[model samples]
Structures are given as C-alpha cells and as structure tokens.
Target: MSDEACRLDVWLHRARFMRTRALAAAFVEAGRVRVTRGGVQQRVDRPGRTVRIGDELVSPSAAA
Candidate 1:
C-alpha cells in the first residue's frame, strides 16, 4: 500500500505517535487512529497496515 506496508506499531513509534510499540498497537486496536480513503476517514485497527508521512492520526490532546 505504501512503499512497503509498515507494521503500524513501528510506524507509530518512528513517527513519534506513541512512546512504545506496544502502546501504538494498543491505540490501533482501540480505534484511536483514522485512516483516510477517497477523502473519507475510517478507523485503523490492524497493526500491519501501511502508513505514510503526513497521514493524520486522531489522538486525544494531552491537555484533554
């Protein structure tokens, strides 16, 4: 899907989305991130999904 379908957990950590791979996988399984398709958003669940730079992640603000 991407240059290579990255392990979502690894991408999340490399992109600074989570402190650890485990946390990234947890967030993904919990439906905390959104994946865009045809300009529509969908929940991301699988840890093996492809991700890319500039892909929006729907995470709660720390202040919230």
Candidate 2:
C-alpha cells in the first residue's frame, strides 16, 4: 500500500461512517463493507485493508 493509503477501519471512522474505529473494524470483518478500486468492486473482510483517496466504499451503516 502507498503511504497515502489509509486503513479501512480508520477511514470509516474518520469519515464518520462508524462512531468508533472498533465498530468500523467489526463492520469490515463482518464483510459488510464493499470497496471499489480501479473500477473493480469487492467485499472488504479485513480492517487492515488499505484504501486510497479515490477508492469508493459502500456500507449499510454509512447510509444511516
């Protein structure tokens, strides 16, 4: 991952998708988060997954 990349959980938390980083991590581990990069979309099942600035993320909780 590049230096500009951010962890999935951290990004979610920072973006206010989840109230806490732990919650974000759990959401990701449960495969509730989908990430799209380079036009390819895939479920992110790990909190450690790297997310770049242009990456798109989709999660049910985020819509709430």
Candidate 3:
C-alpha cells in the first residue's frame, strides 16, 4: 500500500457505496468485495486493506 492509499472501508464510505464505514467493513469482511491490483484480482476480506487510485473494486449488486 502506498501513501496515496486509503482503507477499503473508508474508501467505500467516501464513495457513497455504503451508508457507513461499519457497513462497508462488514461488506468487505464478508468477502463480498473483490479488488484488482497490479492486474491480479483477489477477494477483500478485511476492511483495513488499502486501496490506491488505480485499484478496481468489485462488489455484488445490492438487492433492490
């Protein structure tokens, strides 16, 4: 992780993907989120994971 990186949960919440940081953390911890870094995709099982500007995040669509 670089200095430009931020916590997964913090990024998610700041991006308005989740209503709260806690919810984002839960979503990540549940393995519902995947991150692509350096061309490799992997599950994000921890909220503390760092996400940089180029990182791609994938998550299941929320039920409507």
Per-candidate local distance difference test: 0.74, 0.89, 0.91
In terms of TM-score, the best-performing candidate is 3
Root-mean-square deviation of every model: 2.6, 2.2, 1.8
Off by over 4 Å in 1: 1-5, 62-64
Reference-based lDDT, residue 59, model 1: 61
The stretch of ten residues in a row with the least summed lDDT in candidate 3 is 55-64
> Candidate 1 — which pairs collide?
none
Error of 1 at 19 (Å): 1.2
Q: Write the per-residue lDDT of candidate 2 for residues 1-64, one digit (tens) a residue.
A: 6788999999889988789999989989989989999999999899999999899987774446
TM-score, prediction 3? 0.90
lDDT order, best first, reads: 3, 2, 1
Q: Ten consecutive residues with minimal summed lDDT in candidate 2?
A: 55-64
Model 3, which residues run further than 4 Å from truth? 1-3
**Lowest summed lDDT window (length 10), candidate 1:** 54-63
* Candidate 1 lDDT, 9-56, residue by residue in tens: 888898796899998888888777787755677788887677665565
Q: lDDT score, residue 19, model 1?
A: 94
Best to worst by TM-score, what's the order? 3, 2, 1
Cα error of candidate 1 at position 60, Å: 2.8
Candidates in order, TM-scores: namely 0.69, 0.84, 0.90
